[model samples]
Target: MATKGPEVVTDSKEIAEIYKEFSKFPSLSKASIGPEVISQYGGKYCNIYTEWSQRDLERAEWVKFCRQYIMFYDEDSIVYTGPSGNCTELQGELLTEESPSGIFKAVLRKHTNKKGEEKQFLEIWNKNSKEKSINLSGLDMHGKVYEDDQFGCLVWSHSETHILYIAEKKRPKTETFFQTKPQIDMTEEDEDSIKPEKQKPVKGDVFVYWEDWGEELVKKSTPVLCVLDIESNSISILEGIPDHISPGQAFWAPNDTGIIFVGWDHEPQRLGLQHCTNRKSGLYYVDLTGGNCEQLSSQAKAVWSPRLSPDKCRIVYFEGDVGGPHHRCSKLCMYDWYTKVTSTVVDIVNQPGEDGFTGIYSSALPQNCWAMDSQRVLIGTPQRSRKDLLVINITTRNVTSLTSGSDAGSWTLLSIHQDLMVVTWSSPNCPPSLKVGFLPAAGKEQRVTWVALNETKILPGINWKILTFTPPLEQKNPKFPAMNFEGILVTPSEREEGAPTPIIVWPHGGPHSVFTAEWMLYPVTLCRLGFAVLLINYRGSIGFGQNSVFSLPGNVGSQDVKDVQFAAEFVMKEEFINTSKVFIIGNSHGGFLASHLIGQYPEFYKACAMRNPVINIASELGATDIPDWCTVEAGFEYTTGQLPTPPLLEAMLSKSPISFASQVKSPVLLMLGEKDKRVPPAQGLEFYRALKARGVPVRLLWYPDNNHSLSKVDAEADGFMNITLWFIKYL
Candidate 1:
């Protein structure tokens, strides 16, 4: 870390100026990587990723204009002019998937948004792929297209004759109950009824109830498997899927004979599907010719992401329990298609070995992760403060760490073509950059090589290092063995003996989500402001082994909270930290800890800020989209139709940060998204109102149009700047 020289800001207003300057920093992203199609298009492979939009948009402009450079790049770093696809022209591109033969690309793009409807167009293009945008209501399509990670993945068949996707089924038309039915009556003069007599209507089932997948998938329900015939432009809503399960992550089966997908169970009730791999789901193969829906994986256990090898003889997937930490280190299991057998290739690592391969903390495997040999697959997972790439050979069960240890920052497999692989790497100081490389020998993936696509700009004067900590041995749970966790300490370029820098203790949202030390805008901007940031990976965080993750379920408020508190204690002892100006920040579960910390250790923190935080579990249970989360994380197995008992309520309240509100003295800032369904906006409101009642210095910022993430460029800008200002004021 740098020992000393950047300028310091004594005024909070200076943060706004810094925000505008940082806003000029270009936004770059690289995705949809593929091998060179025609020799003419130079480079080992091709990729599509977006660039920038100023954070200075007016509120109305936020809705009117959203811009980002969704450009294409190859070895030359030039705009894509290839015949396979042209993504640079489209805006709001949702999902892009390549065909098995790599002859074409299918892209989904948002078009317009009329009241109660979301308009989008689907295109399959190299040069002449048609762009079709139709009013879903005109086509009798019910809900908007499923373009999210949960239940929607666009897929193309091997024959290239059809494409398959998921969309919400049109709900049953309803009316108020008790409405009279139309009746036929004979006319007095003709003695024959020419028309049905109008009947007086009283009521109908207009207010009838139906449930949807909460949070990000709130409007999605009862998804139908849609197959589109390419040549005829006709769609077939395949009907063999069990009505009890909602299908997602679908892919075309071998020879395009059937479709393989993960079917999430909505039998009892649908729960939130975002950021959760533990939902009860099964791997199913649905035959296109016969509509035969066959359960390919164990029906009772939760399974997801079934990737068929390039050779088409085998499949690999993740297996976990029905519920717990929404995501954890899961067993990677593979199945032989011909033999109809399944085996655990990488069994769950209860505790990582000293070498540190801590099972698989799956997000989603790349669509093109297969190597040329078809025996190995590449996937990325968080390892301590960094994200590591690993190659897993299903046949041999040998796992190779492509980018191991915290020093590498993070490695994401974009796509692999023939034997050439495309991966993106980014660290605390560097922005994400695309690179082309080749996979190493089978068990020897320990060594790797790469050629950068373009030079990446580094965050000026920024430096960082990974700091490790362990749970107090006496307080550690015996069941959860791997107690050591890590944090990324980001310091400004310069250090001075007399000027100890203010440090922010930042924790992640998942409680299970690992805080990767990558190039994120907010943390980097904070570092540019001369603040040291400690991004924590608490005990229950994923990527550190299942034992570490399973440790926090029944122990949330206490263990996770103490971990943050102890982290601060660990950092405060450092020579360059300003103990008098220590502050904390968290979002979601991280917020839960921040609130607890301020209250539990009243005099320690100078101030605190949280976004869409969980304030009161007891109150949040009835409002949150993921009530299952409330029950499971509170040490109870969620059962459908189970109401909270007095004991459950008591336990939840005791575990909530709200209980400690009275003891809090530090000023607080709450950044909330009104549309957030995961952790309802009310959660933050509850805290804001409490702090108000107690006369604690508090400020609440409402982003009415944003969701749980406050992901809109404007909202993100608003929140980031305010957070900096809040801390600046105190410092």
Candidate 2:
């Protein structure tokens, strides 16, 4: 019943056209997408002020207001272009400064917020007329002042000058700053100069952030608490943690005399600390107001993002099981200051696993990237077997499913403004867009309103339908025979609405990771572009029990790759899927599988795209930056324990895609972030060069400013844009 397959073409002419069309789609090199996220109140929701008599309250209004980047603009204004680009004018009263002669000013920039360019900036305003044209924020990476309203006119100036002018408070122009290299106090390098006496507080290290809170500001590089004084526009440091800590989640205590920060103190290699992990970490409070610090929690492993209630009555944080083989899955815990009692707030232990759909902890998240609010907690439950948005009841401990894992959608809580919550959602098929949802009262369904839809793509207009197919039963590993193996499939809603769609067999990146049916932009983008995406939860992925996840070590090559192959065969049998036009794409571990699939089954796929792929398994083992001590903790030797002595090396090499490069017949597109230290750019370059040398079709794209993950807005856009081109050409 399946649609007719494409005729096999061995002739060079067909392959030539495929390669040429792939090259025609202009590859994106620069950031074309705007800002994807914005935050207020540390990017979480919870109203603070019960009431405010003045326009700005220092603790409730001014302090919180000054902590974030605020946009300024006038309601009545025509768009104008300056020397640099289009601009908007804003005028507001100088809330912080004492200057009586308020100045008015205007600014210019794109209305759409892009990721890296989100820095606030300002220009100069004339003092005489209380008005000035906003100037372009040039090469200076420092924050600036843009607009001011005072007396009768508007004024504006850059924050770099450390000067303030008066202007109207309504839609006033202001400035934003940029990051510049800090001047280190290196004068003491002179051997003769008496070393400045190292000052030590009664207990902790004194940490300070110049503008933003971060650990990078410290000279000694110890884990210290970074604090900001909005009244004085100054920073302070409080140090006392056991080891060097990156500035994780931190906040000034209600007393304001002290602050609290969380960091890890454990064996780095055992827990993959190279990628930022803390084995033994807890909550500690330092009295900047001058008092002995106190330990708030025990030595339970923790993930950063900590939150304090408005009244400072309770502290909420994520707590991981201590000293376990599977410590990654943590639960949400809360501690009450008044009762002096600690308890598990959410029942993560009962959460269902991805494998047998049985309740068990795999992954519970409140990563530094997510936010929380007063009425409910917005938690990222990646282990719900899908990327889920879970709304937790603050008082009753009840959980509600907000958004189902759409495999095509991503939901993020940005900021909270009174009764409204601002969230962002995006997918491969959808341009990132903003949404506002009304905070549901206790025990009520949250009513959400979609706003500012990203107009960059048209995929959302098409409907998508779900498709399911059971993969053939896998022969259990000779070693781990108890493990279960299966795969999942998804199709666009458009298929039943009209015509059959092409197929894209997707393999998740982690040899130990599984792909969920949750909404994601990546696969959604392909489906929107007219392809049926089949994402498999191969043998090694989590959500399944321990046996399933641990099975990956010895099976990354044979069993793992077969899971993908079996998935392809299942979808190919579906009457609605076009079997002939399949393509494969993946990154990191998935990249390894994609490369291997193309080599092993070249005739099955039309093309492939790899992002920061791992080509040589053996090379990765020796060259990976992970600490040498990790070999024992990762259990690599144990997994390959039964291999015969002579063929051990060959077994590892056989799993590597690079070894079989000569067999690859499909066109390949590879991209890597220059700063990605995890799976370095060398991995992709090595494979690209190898395939090109053998006269196989290939293209390589490298991002200079990004890391293992493209966190920057522009870099992410460029990465996704290139992905679009690859599929448009080959599939």
Identify the leading candidate in terms of TM-score. Answer: 1
In the range 464-576, model 1's lDDT, one tens digit per residue, is 88899887887677786547888899988686657788889998888888978777778877888888899989888888887888888888898888888888898889647
Question: For residue 386, what is the lDDT in candidate 2?
Answer: 49
Per-residue alpha-carbon lDDT of candidate 2 for residues 111-227, written as tens digits (9 for 90 to 100): 224655543323233435523223223322122322211011111112222222211111112223332345445453553364222221222212332221111111112223433
**In model 1, what lDDT does residue 376 have?**
88
Question: Relative to the true structure, how large is the alpha-carbon lDDT of every model?
Answer: 0.78, 0.49
RMSD values, in order shown: 4.9, 13.6
- What are the TM-scores, per candidate, against the unseen true structure? 0.89, 0.60
Native-vs-model 2 lDDT? 0.49
